[model samples]
Structures are given as structure tokens and as C-alpha cells.
Target: MMMVFCENSFLSYFPNGHIFQPSDASGVLLFIMTGKVLLNVFLLCVRRQNLHQSFMGYFCISLALLDLVLLVTMSFISHFQNFMLLGIRFTKYHTCLLAQITAFTYGILHYPVFFVAGLDYYFTFTQPLNSAAVCRRWLYTATVAFTWISALCYVLSLPGSAIGLDVNHYNSAYNCPFYISSQTYWFSLGMLMIMCLILILCWSEIVDTVQSVKVITYESETVLFFPYDPECSPRDCAKHLLARLLICFISTWVPFVLLQMLIVLLGAQIPAFIEMNVPWLYFVNSFLIAITYWMRRRHLKVTEETLEADPFVSWKFCLVPFRCQYIDKAQKSTSKIVMC
Candidate 1:
């Protein structure tokens, strides 16, 4: 009789105790979303002040706006717990469902966004946009909008929930239902594996290039220049350029890559909402840029237009040396000072 009475009391206190309570998850999401919002704002300000407006600039600004919207929505959902919206009553479960769907949508967006951004870079580098400034702006705006709209529709149309959240009414504890994104996991794993392979294959060239790389400032812009070596053939220069690019990429993304590795090894299930952030997007941006550069390496030129192509990364630095070497030796010193 005592045990039966104790069980009844427990059920009364925790009506849905068997379900994985999202109170802790909601709290963590709010904290992460707040930090991401601030980070994106700072990045936007920095890009506005120091970088030229390019396709990347537009994409980043749009992403920041999206983050702001999500942050606001999550904040309201967390605070009110339950509310009336559009004449429909929404309980905490509905809010969690909304968040889950949005998070999944955001997770799947990474690939499509990267593909479109890569296309933008390809066209910008291959056939420079000769249209008026207004036309170029419109083109970028349209591209970003299309990518987001398409991704959202595709995710929403999927058959089942990307995340599984179960709510039970019994007073028994259950496991957490955090969603670990397979798409993100595999993408990150593939990148790390490919980077490792490149490191192994080009270890010698990377070492030599690191020793030869020199930094020069021209008109307040820093350019990485490799001194011209008469004995170095065109193929050798290409190898060195690849090495330099690898170094730049690895140095900037070491922390992010390491975190991915740790998660992979431990099989940790990070919530999708928290995984999608400014740093991850920038990491993808850099990867796409590097791939584009590698493909167009033979035709690469360090021109004024190329310098303005990427808002976040100064890829011109990698190509400047090739441009500088073609000039007369007598004018090399002056050209180095003026070209970049």
C-alpha cells in the first residue's frame, strides 16, 4: 500500500516524467543562439568596415539576419512556454517541434548553400561579371534567396521528422533525444580525411613553401609573396601554391576540425540547433573557396577584381607571387610594393 501510494505521488509530481524533458536543451539552445547572434553581428560590422561587398558579403549578411530571427523566436518560445499565435494555442511541445524542424532545415542547408556559393565563385572567377553594379547586386540577392527557399521546402517535404522527440506521461526517466546530424558528421569527416591525405602527399613541398613564404604590405593590404626562384619550374610553383593554400586553411580551421574529430570519436550527439553557427558556415565558405582556387589555379591571376571576390579570406595573397614573378627583375622590387 505504501509503495502504491508513493508511485501515485510521483506520477502527480511528474505527469510526463518518462519523456525526455527539453528544459535543459532549451536553456542550452538559448545560450548558444545568443552567442551566435552577437558573433554574426560583429562579423558583419568587420566585413562592412574592412571588406568589399561581394557575393560572400551578401550571403553572410543574409545568414546573420536569419540567425537574428531564429534567436528572437527561440527567446519568445523559451520565455512564454505556452502562448496563442495566429489564433492557435501552442504548448511547449509544439514549440519544441518547431525548433526541431527549423534545426533540421538549417542542418540540411549546409550542402546546398555551399554548392551555390561554389557556383558563384566559379562564375565570378571564370567570366567576371561585366554588368552594372546594380545588376550584380540583384544577381547575388536572387541566388541567396533561391538557395534558402529551395532548402527549406525540401526539408519540410521530407516524410518523417529529422529529430525524434517523445513525450510520455509516466513518472519514469528516459534517455535524451538529441539529434546528431549525419550530414554534418560525414561532411566534416570527409574534409578531415582529405586534408590528412593532402598533408601526407605534399609534406615536403609544404615544408619548403613555409620557409619561402614572405609577407608584404601594399597600400595597407597584407599580401603573402613567395620569392621568385629561377630554378623552380611551373609545376613546382603549382605544388608550392597548393602547399601555401593548405597551410592557410589548416591554420585558420584547426580548432573547428579538432572539435569535429572529438565528436566523431566520442559519437556525441550535439543538438542540430547549436551546431549551426557562424564559424561552421565560414569554415564551409573557406573550403569551397579553396576548391575553386585549386580548379582555376592554372588561370589564376592576382587582379584588383580577384582581391574583392572573397570578403572573409584574402585568397589574392596566394596568387600574388605568380603575378609578381612575370615582371622584369629590375622592376620586381617596385612591382612588389605597388602590385598588391
Candidate 2:
């Protein structure tokens, strides 16, 4: 029974000779599945309402879903890895469909996030402060609506957008996995350009905003919106550059993407022979989301602070389990899951 279950988890293609080892073990599959499940559960708990502060909720949730897709993709890869090693004949199974879903859905899902971040920054710094965050909540909903539709169009329009092809009548794949092929590189490059443009726009806005200034005459404020140094608020902006860095990562799914580009550009010869610890990149990526979400919690404003200031809230202030974000937000805001 154990071997049968193991075979299902690691694919039953391997019989006589061992082609792969613990690298594709059932244990790893369990871990990946468990971690993704837990992360997503945590996300659902926090998705109770309009995002608490600006786009952070949307940004973080999208990222979490993307990462979950990655984990699901990993499960597919691990389950089929044995086939890659010891299958009697080279085969692609229908199970490969899941991989295609992850790549295509997650691929397009990332673009809106990039555009949203750029647009967010542009509106905040470049536009009138009074008008910032003043849009209808429906506009936010519309943005998401447009995002999914556009992503569908973009993914479907891609050359060979067919998720998988029937390799043989007995087995099939959902989509072409080697997106690095010459035919698809242009599409990938085009997306890279689009995202880069967003990044550049955000960067330019940051620079322009820093150079240009407006006079501020405020009477009394409960919480300092933007934390200020003894000298000035100008100093705080410089130090919290991580804001943009976080934004860049929010939409750009480049790390896994860049790896694929290298494999394609370098060809099978190099990839086949190269013994790389590539999974480490993804592991580190998971570690990053965990830390980023945790840190974001620390920076959230209480009832007294409304400016969205305290740019870098001390993450150490949080010893609370992340689920408590709803309770800790403030008694009036305690029902944060609905708002954020």
C-alpha cells in the first residue's frame, strides 16, 4: 500500500532500475503541498475585505497565489520526475496539464500587479495628494476585472498557446513547457519589456518626486503619516528604498523566468550536463514571501496613524501569529478581513 501510494506521488514509471532518488521523494511532495496549502489558507483568512492599506493586500495575495501555483507545479514535476528518469518509453502524461495551468495562469496574473504598482506610485507622488486613494472601490474591482480578461487574451493569443499536445494517444500535455523556444521568446521578451517599462516608470516617478516638492501646511495629525527624521522627511524616503524593491518583485516573475531563458539560450547540452542547485532559488523565493508578509504586518498603522506613514514599521514589534492581523488592527478596525 505504501509503495502504491508512493508510486502515485512519484509516478509509477520507475520499476527495475532507479533513475532518480530522494530528490523526487514523496516526502518532498508532501512538504511542498503542505506548505502551499497553509500559505493559501492564511491568505484566505486575511482576504475578508478591501485591502487594509492601499494595494498591499492585493499585492500580497496575488503573490501568494502565484507562489501557490508554483508549488502546485512543483508537485506535478515531482510526481512525474520518475517518468523523466526510468519510464519505459519517453512519455508525457495528461497530469502535465496542471503544469500548464500554473505557467499560463500565473504568468498573466503577474502583469497586472506590475502595472498596478506603477500606477499606484504615479498617482501618489505625481498627482495631487488630496486625490490619492480617493477612487471608487468599484474602480479597484474593475481593475481586477480588466486584469483577468487581459491575461486571458494575452495567454490565449500566444503562439502555441495550447497548454499540452497529445504526444501519443495514451498520454498528453496541457501546454508547451519549453516556452523558451524561439517562437515564444518574443512573447516573453515583449512581456519583459512591458514590465520593465512599468518598473522604469515607477523609478522615474520616484526620482522626479524627490526633486520636485510642494509646500505643506498641516495643523494637527494623530499619527505621522510619513515618519520624519530629526532633520526632515526627505531622509526617511531615501532609507526606505525597499518600497520600490518590493513593488518590483510584486509583479515581476523574473527569477524562475530568467532561469528558463538561460536553459533555452544555453540549449539542452549545457542544461543536461550542468549540475545546478536550481531549487534553491525557489526555496529562497518562498522564504522571501514569508518574510515580506510578516514585515508588512509590522508597518501597518493603528487608529492614531492615518497617513500610511511610519514607512518602515519595525517588524520586531510583531511577535503575534500572523492570523491575529484582524484582531490587532484596532477595535474599530478589528473586522479588517472584510475591509482589507
Candidate 3:
């Protein structure tokens, strides 16, 4: 009776009743996992000095640790397949079952993790706290823990955890089935569409803004600035700067946008487990930060403190270049201005 119920649950993931052989999917998964692990390790090491200095740092370190754990678990699972473990021999079916469950859990985790990271930034900026550093650290830790626990609970509560474990049975050589999160798919699609629209709508403005922008180094940081124009009002200046920033961002992440487009056009069903990597997270992070800056553009002040928030991306360079007064002051200190 239990076997029958499990089989039915597994079959539901494939309503088409067609199970294809895994082919190179397992190899691809392993390669992706390895790359993610290496990237996370490099980031953690690079930022080790400031790993816990800010909420972003904590979030990044936590993500790195999670990626490491997943990589190790997958490696062990692959190693133990067809081997004896505590007097129990693991078959392909058992191996795929474990992989699917793990993939499902990791796949659904992206949203919650990104949400918590955003919240951390939002609260840090909006709700200025007078608490000590220790208290702040504890608060960030609790938020991170909440995201992980909530995501885990939600994944486990789903029927059969939304994984198709029967694929391996049909093809003994099949690697594993991975869950594709609809939430992630839609989120990626929405972001790509929005960026494309923004680029299209503001292409002329962006091009004009980029042409006027000058790049210079201020206090060891690259800064973008434009000469004072009598006709351009402060608001217009801000808009132009923001447009230029978007262009810069889109240029940096053009490959990611193209990949998302290709996936949509080709109807590729990339496993969420493989899609949730360091690059994807950073891409999302930059987009969220850009949105936040745009929302608060009127109130934004180009100061050294504000630029220090994001460790990975130097968004300050984009923000500081537009403030004429700031640029005037910088002109006194440096003479390395160049046109963009």
C-alpha cells in the first residue's frame, strides 16, 4: 500500500507520462555545483575581513556556507551510490530520491533568502537602530535563520515535496530529477522583461547621459560626474544619472538577461537547483539595490558612508558622479577625470 502511494505521488510530476533519460543532466549538475562552491569560497575568502561587518556580508557568508553544504552533500551522495552504507545497499532509485528531495529544498530556498536579504537592507536603512553591534548581529542571524527554517518547512509540507523520484526506475542510468520552481521562473522572467522595457523606453536619455558622464577617481573609489549645465535642473540631473546607472547595470548583466531570454524562447526547463547560483543571486541583488536607489533618489545623499553599504558592487560610483557640488570638491583633490 505504501509503495503504491509513493509511486502515484512520484508519477504526478510527469503528467505527460513520458520519462526521458537524464543523459548529461547529472554531469551538468555536478559541474554547476562545483563552480558555485569555488565561487562562494573565493568570495568568502576575499571578504573574510568583513564577513560579519554588515547585514549584506552576513547574508553572503551564509549563502556561501549553504552552497558549500549542498556541494558536499551532493558529492557524498554521488560517491555512496551503488555502495554499502551501514549494511544497506543504495540503488539508483534511492539515490535519485535523495537528490530530488535535496534539489527541491534548495530550489525553493532562493526566494526566502533573497527576501530576507532585502529586508535586512531595508530595515538597516529606514529603521535606524541605536542598538549595539552585537544586537544588530543577533538580529541579522535570527532573520537568516527564519528564512532557512521557513523555506525548509514549506518544502517538506508539499505533496511528495514536488519531486519526481520514479524517473530513475524507468531508465536505470538516469541520474536524478530536479524540481523547477515556478516562482523563480516568473521572477527571472519579470526582471528580464522590466529591464528590456526600461532600456527601450529610455534609450535616448541613457545614451545622452552616458555621453555627458565623466569618470574620475575620488578617495580610492571610481566616481562618475558630469560638468554643471545651466539648463539641466537637479531633478533632470538625477534622472540622467539614474538612467546611466541602469545602462551600466544592464551592460554588466547583459549575459544573464540573454540567458533568461534564451531559456524562455527555447522552452528550456532548467532545474531550479542548478539555476540558484552565486551569479544569479548577485544579479538579483544588484537589481534590488538599483530599485531601492531609484525609489529613494530624491533623498539620496552622495556620501562616503552610503557607498560602503554594498561590498560587491561599487554603486557609489554611479551615485557620486552626478552631484555637481561633490564633483567640485573632488576637482580640488584629484585631476584624473576622463570622459565615459
Candidate 4:
């Protein structure tokens, strides 16, 4: 009697995991749908910015796009095609397997993208990056092609018995995702370990780069290779390096890193509690990737207080609405001025 009164269903997400009755179905669908839409809009914004030419930006966007596909497929498509009723057991195991596999692949694969993103930032800060060019675009495109092909091959290679990723049966006519066999789980887990090692190496190098810069800043008088105007706010450039960077790595990847170790290394079952907490992971990834695009597309507006210090002005400023470019000179100077 007590069990009947409280929620008996095991909800997959936590902080709101208990589902007492069947009426909550609509709410769940709505939640999933909203996440799906945000993800897509974020990706579209990323694509328009052509940060696709930059390896880190491109990879992050790719990761977001892959997650968008996997989540939507899980939310809507998998639900429909994946598990039909067999009195209580679900059917269409193949679809569920494919969806689950793709989701896992995206989850595992984004590790490389994050590593690349961190590396790009580290390189930008520590080493000379070549000017962006047409050939660079081709390289990024080629790399994207290779990653997609490899991931696709991995997904299609799953065995038939692992078709439906069913961890357990659902009550009523339900469609839970399928589960790979223990052997395959270990295999997937191993891939995640390799991903972790790569991220750690990249992060280690980034730290070294930062420490080296710190040493040079205080210990040596070497002029910065690319000088910044001392009068300008350091925050302007530093915002990209410090604040945005922390959000990209710590917020986006740290939860993922812990989960990778938990699920992959320990083979420990992640509490639905932790899994649900990271619901924002996809949203944040989309947001960060979208932010890079936003940064790229943004015009650097030099206000009155800051304009005097700009080393040079871009001619594009002439197109700004109602903005003025004026010349002021003393009467004597004006007479001496020559039009060239």
C-alpha cells in the first residue's frame, strides 16, 4: 500500500527521477523536445560562423551536432521505431541498438574534439599559429570526413544480439534503450580510457605553456611577439583566454571526464543521479560552440575611450550605421596638410 502511494517507476534522471503516475509522460516529452531544439539552433549558428575552418571550433561543433542527432533520435525516433510492445517486452531492437550505439559513440568521440579545442587554445597562447587560409579549410574538412567515417563504421559494426540496448524491462508499453553485452561494454570502455589519456596529455601541455608564459612575463624582458596596446582593457582579450576557456573545459568536459572514468574505467554503474545532473552537458557544449561562432561574427567596436589606442582601424568601420570619421587639425596644421 505504501509502495503504491509513492512513485514506483524508476526514472532515469535524478533531482526529479521519481514518477508516481502515467500522467507525467507529456512533461517528459516536452523536456526532451526543448533540449533537442536548443541543440539544433546552436549548431546552425555555429555553421554560419565558418569556425568550421578552425580545428577546435569545427570539432566542437561536430561534437554538438552529433549529440544533437543522437539525443533527438533517442527522444523521438528511437521511441517510435525502437521498442514496440510484446505484451510488456519491447521490439524493434535494432533501432534501439543503433540509436544507443550512436549516442555512446558521440559521447566517446567528443573527447577528441575537446582535446583538439584545448590544444588549439594552448597553441594560440604558446606558439605561432599560421594565418587562416583556404588550404586550412580543406584540412579541417578532411579531418571531419575521416572522423565521421570511422565513427560510422564503429556504429554499423555491432553484432545482432546486441541489437536492442535493453538494460532492463520497462513497465507497461515502454521503450528503454538497448545495452551492449559485457564484452562490448568493456570494449567501449577501453575506447573511453584512450580518450581520457589524450585529454590529459593535452591539458598537461596547456599547463606547461601557461607556466612558461608566466616565467617569461616576470623573469625575462622579452617583448611579446604579438603586442597588445597597454591602454586597452586586458579583459577584452583575456575574456577569451580565461573566462570562456574555463567554461569550455571545466564545465563542458570535466563532468564528462569523471563519467568516462566511472563508466569506463571502474565499470561502475553511474548513478542515474550523476547522469541526470549532466543533462546540461549537451546544452553547454552547444552554448560554447555557439559562443565561438558568436565571437567570430562579432565586430570589435572601439568606443571613444578606447579608439585612441587602437594600432590601426579596419576600413569596415566606414559601413557602421551613422558612424563618423572626421579629421581635426589646427588652422596652421590644416594649411600645411597635403592630400595624398
**For model 1, what is the alpha-carbon lDDT of residue 122?**
72
Alpha-carbon TM-score of each model against the true structure: 0.76, 0.37, 0.75, 0.37
Clashing pairs in 1: none
Please give the lDDT score at residue 278 for candidate 2. Answer: 20
Window of ten residues with lowest summed lDDT in model 1: 1-10
* Candidate 2 lDDT, 1-340, residue by residue in tens: 0011121222222121111222322344346445655755564563323222334334444545555665665566556743533433223333333333333443334334544644443343223234335463445556655665676566545543343323352233222221111222333455446446545645654444334322121222111121111232544443233333333243233465575557446643211001111232222232233233334434533322222211222211122222333322333331211100
Question: Which ranges in model 1 have alpha carbons more than 4 Å from their true place?
Answer: 1-23, 48-56, 160-178, 228-230, 322-340
Clash tally for model 2:
16
On residues 1-340, what C-alpha lDDT tens digit does candidate 4 reach at each position?
Answer: 0111101211121122222222333334335545655754554453323222345445545655655555565455445653445533333433333434443344344445444543443333233346566766677777876876785566444333223334243234344232222332343465455445434544543343334321111112111111111233544433323332332233334655465556665655421211321233333333333333224323433333211111111111111222112111111122321100
At residue 85, what lDDT does model 4 achieve? 52
RMSD list, candidates in order = 8.5, 14.7, 4.9, 15.6
Q: Candidate 1: what lDDT?
A: 0.62
Q: Any runs in candidate 4 off by more than 4 Å, and if so which?
A: 1-34, 43-53, 67-95, 124-132, 152-175, 178-340
| TM-score top scorer | 1
Which portions of model 2 show Cα errors greater than 4 Å?
1-34, 43-53, 62-92, 108-112, 124-135, 164-306, 309-340
How well does candidate 2 score on lDDT at residue 199?
51
TM-score of model number 2: 0.37
TM-score of 3: 0.75
